[model samples]
Target: MSVDSASGVTVPEPVPAGVVLRPPDSSVRRNQRLLARLGWLYSAPALLLVAAVTIFPIVFSVVMSLSHVTVSGSGFALGGFTGSNYSAMFGAQLWRYALEFTLAYTFGTVLVEIVLGTLVALVLERLTIARGWLMALLLIPWAMVTVISAELWDYIYNGVYGVGTSILHDLGMQQPNLLGTPTAAIISMAAADIWKTTPFVSIIVVSGLVMLPVELTEAARIDGANGWQIFWRVTLPQLRPTLALAVLFRILQAFGLFDLPYVLTGGGPGNKTESLALLGWQTMFSDLDFGPGAAVAVSTAALTLIGCLLFLKVFRSQVGKEEL
Candidate 1:
């Protein structure tokens, strides 16, 4: 202790155990800002690449959708801004039909795939033998390119010499023109999609299942919970987020349905199987209507974004309710 010169009062020296507060050095702040700038410098190349590939195309599509676009011998020429593209898209009957077909097809296929995939994952989770081999086999369809798979399905649905046709003929179904009719074409295309994509969902769910804590199920079993009870009370809730992730991925991919329908049915039998993506493709490439085609693409992207947002909101609310 010492007396202060100005106040003539005894003051205690600071204890070694007490924290001493001081203003941060300007050098420290300068160093932090320098580090942040370097970080951004390092990230700039990849960010520019993403902008070139993804953001530029999306912005260009939106611009084309909202403008008058013409294709010349040189390339696409953009005219003055106009709403005619969107107006034409909204006025078209094919647009309405394609929107409906895309939504319905996405809903049906995604729901079926999720259910079947979850079941497959559950079974695979319980397997004690050849699990790795079985998983590899299951992924074969998903690993195959969509165009190749679609071609394979096209052969299988061929009216004359298809294995499927032969089997059905043996069972007395006279004419199973799988891709010849509207309803059959839609169903056949959906079947092909589900066959190739279900394994993707199964892989995702299997990963989630592998990460799940075993203690919860074990404790539930000790509490006299049956398999079904344990699954319902313990597993399903935990798997909700995993299922939501699978659903989101499926929704995005399914809403943009093109390759399967294009390769298998060619959107034929009165354009009954034409999806939004296929419609956009036909409008852009076949008719060379870039503006309206861009509008269709933009509309489809907007719808997909809205659908995913709504699903996430509903899922969050459900999770909140379960927590409550």
Candidate 2:
């Protein structure tokens, strides 16, 4: 090519050493496309099943929420689409109460769970003896079915001849009916939730604690950092993501608060303990108002999604500041 340039004639550039030029193979690309198509074909059944199981129900629920639905012997009879369902939900005082109660319950329980769970995880992380046995014991509460756990709590809070009542009576609190009143019922439900789910949070946090880089803590200690200082400065920042994940999971589950209130209080004491889930159930199954019920469900889902998004945004901003 240089000699051809000197000769002032057009010439192809010389190929670099250890390089080869060749035409692209159309067959290779065709084979790759075929494999991709085959993979999609193989996955199509599972995708369809997932749609049937999850997506269809969601879409149907949204549709039901938007329509005038009536229950018949045949099935749900859907009438013309209307906004009455959401309007009724918005105008009803019971819906407002349930929304407020559910939000309060979710906030209180998730906050307590995160704090208690993180403490438990920290303690568990430092324990070198019987850690597995301790963890198994801790997990018992979480492993129990929610219904069964609620039932057990129900028994404990029974107005008469119950263990909690008996202990309270002996402590000079006479006739302390734990679930007989609004405030007491709310507290009892929150206690049961905290007791049952704190272990779950602890497990997640413990896993994160286990995976944290030990070198950071050691370095912090070598720099004259105390245990509290190390925890605040070195440990907590790294654990932010794990804590955010735990918060997200707990918020989602707690916002759908139902089983505990249903089994323990039955949304009783003047429906003070009624949650959005309980309200939806009562509206649909008890009142046979499927449209408003679906609206309640859809609203709960939307609120939960919004709350989680806001939390994640705040968490990300906080993490960014910490990183900076």
After superposition, candidate 2 runs with Cα above 4 Å error:
1-24
Candidate 2, 177: how far from true, in Å?
0.4
Model 2, 138-253: lDDT tens per residue?
Answer: 99999999999999988898887678998999999978989998999899899999999999999999999999999999998999999999999889989989999999999999
> Which 10 consecutive positions of candidate 1 have the poorest summed lDDT?
14-23
Per-residue alpha-carbon lDDT of model 1 for 1-324, expressed as tens digits?
Answer: 989999999999876776876657997899889999999999999999999999999999999998888799998999999999998899999999999999999999999999999999999999999999999999999999999999999889899999888888889999878888899889889999999999999999999999999999999999999999999999999999999999999999999999998998778888999999999999999999999999999999999999999999999999999999
How much lDDT does each candidate structure score?
0.94, 0.93
After superposition, the stretches of candidate 1 with alpha carbons farther than 4 Å from their true spots are 1-24
Ten contiguous residues with the weakest lDDT in model 2: 1-10
Q: In candidate 2, which residue pairs clash?
A: none
Candidate 1, TM-score vs. the true structure? 0.90
